[model samples]
Target: MHLFADMLARVHAAAAAVLGPSADLTRIVVEPPRDPSHGDMATNAAMVLAKDAGQKPRDLAEAIAAKLLADAKVEKVDIAGPGFINLTLKGEVWPDALRTVLEQGKGYGRGTVGAGKKVNVEYVSANPTGPLHVGHGRGAVFGDALASLLVAAGYSVTREYYINDAGAQVDVLARSAFLRYREALGEDIGEIPEGLYPGDYLKECGAELAADYGDRLKAMPEAEWLPIVRLRATDMMMAEIRNDLARLRIVPEVFFSERSLIEGELPDPFSKEPPKPLVDVVAETIAALREAGHVYEGRLPPPKSGNLEDWEDREQTLFRSTEFGDDVDRPLLKSDGSYTYFATDIAYHKSKFDRGFADMIDVWGADHGGYVKRMQAAVKAVSGGKGQLDIKLVQLVRLLRNGEPVKMSKRAGDYITLREVVDEVGKDAVRFDMLYRKNDAVLDFDLAKVIEQSKDNPVFYVQYGHARGKSIFRTAAEQGVLPADPAALQRADLVRLTDSGELSIIRKLALYPRMLEAAALAHEPHRIAFYLYELASEFHAQWTRGGKESPHLRFIIQDDPQTTQARLALVQGIVTVLASGLDLLGVEAPEEMR
Candidate 1:
């Protein structure tokens, strides 16, 4: 029962009837009045549709007001300056909305904005080189929460992780692992090379190689043993990555390998044959773009950065991305006649479109901001303007402890690992703190501040709100004032809840469904975090007012059980909404704080 949605529908219907059924009512919206003293809700329908109605804004507002005043829920309709319509719903409407919240429980705020559209969300595509760092944690938490939010809004989403296995970095990883292999065989390897990875986590991979084939890999040539070592090291590293992600409760449905796009084969899922010929997707993608006149051999001007020393003036295969709104045309091949990174990226996204997904989202680090336009252009050219690609760039995190920068991990050798952060403080604190700010802004994560059991910490404050609600039920049942069963509590008389503070809590709870839909459409999970904090703050304030302002406003009254039961019903609504909103952000709602 979304109150604003219902009222907006009625306004649209009335506007259509008065404007001859052909009016553009999409712009008409029902929202809370900017100033609470004005009214409960306000609409701009009259102002937006007055031109088509061929009447003054106030005249149309009066006619629409007349139609709305007849509604049972709307108690009063007032016309303000220049065609603004303000609606004040009946007092009973608030109680009925609370009853709906109790009836739905955890399913209270679920919406239907997505309508079952298939969306592919690819995130945390960190290379299988080593352990994940704090920067990777931000993107992982953002993408995972965004996927949960879309599902709550009725979108069929697939969580994916793109494995960057085929690149020069993995070669460097292989060389680094080989040194550890020599050390594992009881050889004197004093120091790691300057260009290779120095993380001590690779020692386990080298030890495994030694245990499986003792002195066997030492005799083989570098070319022969490189592939064998690369496979084993990559498998071991990916296993470690999975374990790390599991600690944070993040499990991606698909782990698509980047190497598969170029070297491996993809079978046509729609083919009649069991196993068709191995298709070279990258080559086929380039040929298709060539046929469509989007690909050609041309020389790009020197880069705008003025670093022309490394620039080559010779003609190379290029993609005409400037025609599709990119800054300039992009190259598809390097000087050595090999496919560029952008070329393979285009083919990978085309594969997502081929698999029946028209909406795709990629979550990348802040450093990848310059790559968004080119990728979007490629999606437009490859999908024939039918597919949509949205790229979200997550900024880096500054790890701190008591206002001091935390030192880097010895195991990772350069930066702090995500595993270490989760191990120190539980998953809930890490996740909520990461999403407490916008994805595009710089976040300062303080280890000491997040674990404080005080109002300054948002995670603790919100979880305490849930615990406080449960505490009221426990205290009430102890005094034999009311039953703890939700079914029995739902039958409580809600009309007794007439306090302005109590109604304020109900109004906040009623806005959850609308906030969730807007956040999902905008691809921002921080909105959910912010909404939960505000609701918790309001509930806490109302609880304090009960003790300081009036005794009759208290939740549990020993002499009268009816008012106590009614207040408990309000608590039920508060806890239900708080739990649902916390779950969407991948945070836990605890039953008790201590």
Candidate 2:
């Protein structure tokens, strides 16, 4: 159904026949020309094939153009600047493309780009200590959209969230909840002590504790009270995190707990038999790695930025990450006999690989950029070079209001939560605007601009296109010109859609499948956002032109029901594609936003 791909296949065959079937065709790329006047599509095959064919580039271009002109799809072929061959397809081919779009509908952009490979996407693995902030929201949205994109490209995807419940952060959470519990018992707890969370969200945990146990836990020792409070608070915080994710339309297929990795015999709460702990499983994997010479005792230098005042130079259990291209070896254990964060991460990734995931993608914050090389090296070590790990670092978002930066104090309570952003501008605006730029580049999310109901706002522009398309259907219904059924619209005389404005929209619609494949293969969901904006721009421009020049060319026609149905079919195609793209980004395709 992709005209571009079909045209490229014909060119590939012709080029192979001319080059005597031995030429390498890997570098051949057929894409839409930057300038529409160049042609419907352009290819640099002649230039790429010239050196191998031992001929001047233009000579090869003319030769290839002669072969392409013989194909029925190529109505005209022009040799442009620097041996670029531009092919203008026949007009009839475009209506067929629209027919394909209507026939496929939601499945229009589906492609087998990934070839059914198993990919594991680990994202939003926030610590079970508190609510997710705006930073975590970016990663969550990026990762979830990436997963959906891969699925659209025919890859089996596992959406996963890693719970950091086995770390010092959870311990801190335990202490903080214990303080709140004391306060709930009417104890006048002074200013929150150091090394404990001070967020007001913890008051509910204290209240729940007070309701469950009147004074039974008041006299308990720290050892007994700490575990109970930690478990209870972690559970509550994770539930809150899940709800927050739901608000943003992100749901993970798997929630891997870090605490499950420790070695112990514990009864399964739902079953009678005791299950083996994950710590033993990780230890066994480490032993296998050690047998393969990837683990050893080593000392690591202190990190460059953070203050490590308690730093003691000593050899510790380390992963041989340096052998696999890491800058330095990483320690698995700290001096106090506790596992470092890297250790648990390594175990978690190893578990993913053991589950038969050879392709893994990790979405982390920009601050974790330094850890990418080591994590990749660990994956190579544990998987014995059979697995690949791709780490995507999402840069920090600078929130702005009315052109001024919003200052957030992590130590104080003056920070914005993900829920706040979602509530203020709405989930659709937040998701689309967050993903409208490249993930590696810092994004300036201006609150005022996103919420503005104007064409200058891209979120509104694209959604307005969808709404306008639906509005055409409403207008047709009001004029007694609505299509009797979807099939009637599908079978509308699309040949009537031959005007420049109508054909341009069809051309944009035709690019969706190929665009999806490219965006998915590149692991860039932002490309979809950018494409939606451009498509909406095309649709809106055409609508505005029709308003001034030819009102009959507009979507609805009261005088001619057949033309109205055909035009409505075109509008339906636009709406289908916009909705599909927005769905991949987890954004809403709003019918009305005013």
Candidate 3:
């Protein structure tokens, strides 16, 4: 149960009672006291609502304090600062929270903060030109973990990938595969010419074309062969990408192709009719914006910092993004009358809105930070302010081995692929290390250190903590201190866990639901990773403390079976929370670590 959320609701109700039901309670927040000496929770209800209510902050606090004094759960209410209400709950409340964790087990930290809202999270939309790289892995791991986090918080989330198959890059991929195809047909294709994909991955596509069509494709003209080859190469590359994503366990619900947005008859491949707009999505988006008065013909200013070598000033189709909080108006088309990347993206996001996603999140590389404002403004213009677009930018990744930088890859010849990293270190290490830091921050993923089974290794430490909890349960069973069945062990007298260390761990366990709620609201899965590390550290600290001079704090006591069972229950609580959190992170919580 969300104890703090419950208390905040009570505090809001008390404020409403004191200052009429019409009082605005939105600004008030009840949070854990920074300095634990103050109280369990402190609220800023009076301070936030005081000026609007036309009363002194302290006086308003006193009035609300009087109303809260009658609550059965509140042992004391201390007023501090201008109007902060510090509340200390009954001591037994902590023990009751421990019981709640025991009873909930796997469901201990499940939260309902999302209220079953539908959210679409699109990530790892890497160009289907090649295998996913380590940078893409960060986004894949992050998006998967974020989706799982939202599910834990009661949101129905759709994980998606926007396939960029219609771009010029895929045409390049087609040309590259054609070279390999010629090699397959005994043409002895020499050195891969510049400006075409040189990766060996497309050789399979070349071989497949040779095996399926034999010389049929080679006999066709460039235009006819190019279409069939581009489609085949893109499909094969996308399949390879899906296989790599499976290594990381990221299965996107939808692979929305960018080429599918243009919904009209294609100009005949044989007919030379100047390619009738092909049901341009970009044109449709511009028309919609024009109808809304957000689109206009305008010229954009030149670059701010770069040399204006090729800068051209001409009136063109533009979206008035400045009206929606963007810094400037954005171009919707290039000089060639084709849709720019921004225009197609606008159509893509609008399609998401069309599919019933009121809330949409796009995980992008840090280089795309400048692209955020325009996209958000476009969503506002398209959805008429009914849709929300949240873009998270993941920064660069630095791959290292031990303390030395590790670079280059045999597969891609330029950089390490995502599958290579996953093969070098297990998926758990790759995913956990990627998320152990914030998305916006640059990450240093050390291969050697990540695999080390030390406390310094956050993933191993947390997994080891789960294994240690299992060890305690096994020890308890062998000593006949508790039953092997978890349901029976949960029947222990938890009131016996009065020690400060035991209560501290129990309090940490109680914070899981609140942590998950906050993480989901903030759209940050790193919070879960960081929380798991701290939880493991606290558990290990208590265990080491017990080994030192605190024998009474030991989880297993030979003479006192009841106390042992109670401590074993706490161990089970730790294991349940760790496993649940690890499961959310797509990390394995091993019963025993080797």
Candidate 4:
């Protein structure tokens, strides 16, 4: 249903006919003009086709433009800048787009980019040791928005959070909570001993422990009480984390615990199959790979920089990740016989493949960049080359307030919590600001800028656009010019919306479907955020243009109810698109933000 896709199809058919069995139109690309003055759309078909056709680029562009000009959709075609064919479509197509936008409402941008395939998006798999900091916030927002974008583009997506509760980090968290529990029992516990978590957030876990067990736990030894305290404390921390995620409007469909991967029974509980815990799954996977000649016993070199006085050379179980494109073979097991984190991760992904999700995406921080290739190798080897893994690395977020950096140190227990930021600037500001920049680019989130209710800020700019459309509907109602029913608005004589300002707004509305498909296919939600800003800017400019030019161009018309209803229909389309785009980014499209 995308107008651009339809136009491109027509161009492709015509180009194929002209070339007559000699040309491949797969390389032809149609894109919006970088400069609006160029045209509504531009294509590099001629430039791309000329090299193979043995003709000069300009000569080929002229020929393509001649063929396209005969089409009913093409109002005008111009050959520009060597070989680009710029096309201006007829104005009649725009009102139909407006009607479509209004009819579909929030579903206007939905598309079939994923073709009903099942994809698993694993993100925000933070350790249950502590609260998510600003760094985690970046991945959380990017992953959640990317999942939503995939769903909009027709993928059956499973949003997953892999909890790292099986690692040494949880042990530290348990010990930290144990200290707090003792302190809660009125024991004179000295200064939060070194190498333990020092965050005040664990204070509540301590209080909960006291409420559950009173002073009875104080008499128990470390080994006796540690497991009970750890389980309860970890559960409490996870609950707090869930609450924090709720504040940011992020909800993962599956909270897959790393501990559960090893502790739980196998999928076929009644079958003779052995209980495949995460660790056992990894061991079995490695054994199977060895049988297939993909796993080998190997020795790893010492670290490049650190002192290796304690480093002992020994053969270890290794995955031949280099054969599948990793830089080197990866160690599946450490020298201590315990499975490395990567080993468990391989089993985790194999589980995803076993469950029939061949397409997988993992959203990780930039620090995890080194891990991507090895993970992809594991997915390929385990799935027998049937499954694919796409890892999106989200760069860091620099938190700022009033142009000054917000300094934080996790080691010092002074890191800014995601919940605190959500509370301070509100969820809409946090989500939009986090997604305003590309995921791989460092984002500068200025608290003051996000909360500002002005055009200078994108969140406010888009929200104001939706609110302005609502304001017009309210004004039309007050003037007794509002449509009596949805059908009345649908039957609007949209031809009256022929003014250049109105037509430009309608053109922007027409771009939503195509933009959604592009963003979803690229796995980039920032594109939606950027598109909403541009759409809002166009609507605002059109509204402001009417103020300076014809006052009759205003949305409300006291004496002309037909024209007023038509403009109101256009306004409704704009609001629907703005709200829909914001919804994908997890931002609020407020009716009135004042």
Give each prediction's root-mean-square deviation over alpha carbons. 3.6, 3.1, 2.9, 4.0
For residues 1-594, write the lDDT of model 1, one tens digit per residue: 577678889888778777767788988978778888777889999999888778999999999999888888889999999999999999998988888888888888898879999999999999889999888988999999999999999999999998887767887888889989999999999888799999999999999989987888899888767767777788789898888887877889999877778766333232375764555678899999999999998888999999998678998898999988999889888787777889989999999999888999999999999999999999999999999999999998999999899977968978889999999988999999999999999999999999999999999999999999989888887888768476877888899988888998888888888889889999999999999999999889888887956778889988888888889999989999999988988898999998
Clash count of each predicted structure: 0, 3, 0, 2
The lDDT values for all models are 0.88, 0.86, 0.88, 0.85
Candidate 4, position 548, lDDT:
54
Clashing pairs in 4: 261-278, 262-278
Model 1 regions lying over 4 Å from their true place = 47-62, 78-84, 265-279
How well does each candidate superpose onto the true structure, as a TM-score? 0.94, 0.92, 0.95, 0.91
Better of 1 and 3 by TM-score: 3
Write candidate 2's Cα lDDT for 249-352 as tens digits: 99999998877776432342334665654356567766777788888876768867566884557988878888999987777777788778888778888999
Query: Could you say which candidate leads in TM-score?
Result: 3
- lDDT tens per residue, model 4, 10-72: 789768766765688878877789999988998999989998898999998888888899998
Better of 2 and 4 by lDDT: 2
**Higher-ranked by TM-score: 3 or 4:** 3
- Identify the runs in model 4 with alpha carbons over 4 angstroms from their true place: 19-28, 46-64, 80-83, 210-225, 265-279, 302-312, 408-412
Give model 3's TM-score versus the native structure: 0.95
Query: Model 1 RMSD to the real structure?
Result: 3.6
